[model samples]
Target: MSAGDYPQVGQGWAFPPHWVRPVPGPASVVTDHGEERIERSLQVLLRTLTGSRVMRLGFGSGVDRYVFEPRTPDACYRLADDVRRALLLGEPRVIVDSVEAVAAEDADDRVDVVIAYRIDRHRRPNSLVVPFYLAGAR
Candidate 1:
């Protein structure tokens, strides 16, 4: 089946559930399919976005390096655009509509990223928001 046909109703092998409380054990196992795949994909995307891309093997290819900046609002906006590009380049099944990043009101070191996109075969637009912190920025 094509990527567009992912999470096929009971067709694809089940993937582990994305979330688990405290710690994951045998009882934490959960079957995932259909739309669940989208959620999982988003989780993967987030991980990739938060990590730095390494040329060598074992290192994740991500946009985290771009996430750090001058801490200006305009910088955040550029970061969002760079994130959108990164996601599109990384995931073929995703058609990105927009990526918006706004500085957190309560924290100067944090920015909230809102991503809007649609899957290849899915009609509805999906959105996810992630807050990123400038770890070493002062």
Candidate 2:
């Protein structure tokens, strides 16, 4: 879908019930379509945006691995792998679990652009906010 189809920009996937508080397990929703959602969101944002404003994702170890990988010298095709993995196994937890991992990953350098999961409910001292400020500055 296109950015217009998304309706909201920078907002990533929601944590499936599995990742929810008091039960941080495998959220079937997250386990099912999290990564796909993120990849699509990034694609849509990149297509819709005017400049290279960093992308911050709240993903997990898997999300951090591929999306953050410097595949084409300057390009990080992280979601490509995640999508592949999901497609291969027909899973979503891996994708959704990675959604919260965005705080650790360096996308847009902040917690605003494409942040995923429970950032508002689980803000830590080191939670990424650089982009939030940068976006605000602009």
Candidate 3:
């Protein structure tokens, strides 16, 4: 049977095969139901944002370029744009609804991003929040 045909290991979000480890590792190799696909997409987004361009053979559009700059209003806007673009290029399964960057009041070099997206399979939206702290940023 195909990956989708297998039963999900649990309710709610399904774990992707790779993310689930075998026995003794707490995680188990489960079926990639609809939720797993979205989970994998989020994982890919995180990896793409943390990685740098040319670091991978075929995939690029990393958001690390904006991490070193000062966390100004304009800089946050640029970071959001960069993240949106990266998501578009890296993960095609989901549609990017909006990317909003907000300055963290607790730190001058920290910013929080709220990502709104819609998976192609459904009309309901999902949101992901990522916090970035640019230590020693100029």
Instruction: Output the number of the TM-score-best candidate.
Output: 3
> In lDDT terms, which candidate is top?
3
TM-scores for candidates 1 onward, in order: 0.63, 0.19, 0.64
lDDT string for model 2 (84-134, tens) is 343234323222223222222344433222323221222221111112211
Question: Against the unseen true structure, what C-alpha lDDT does each candidate score?
Answer: 0.64, 0.31, 0.67
Model 1 steric clash pairs: none
Residue 10 in candidate 2, Cα distance off native in Å: 29
When sorted by lDDT, best at the front, the candidate numbers are 3, 1, 2
Candidate 3 lDDT, 1-138, residue by residue in tens:
334432342234444334566667687545454545665656566556443446665464455676687777888888788778778877776788999989888777888888888765445777888887664344
Q: Any runs in candidate 3 off by more than 4 Å, and if so which?
A: 1-32, 49-60, 135-138
- Give the Å error, residue 113, model 3: 1.2
Off by over 4 Å in 2: 1-61, 71-79, 92-138
* lDDT at residue 34 of model 1 (Cα atoms): 51
Error of 3 at 117 (Å): 0.6
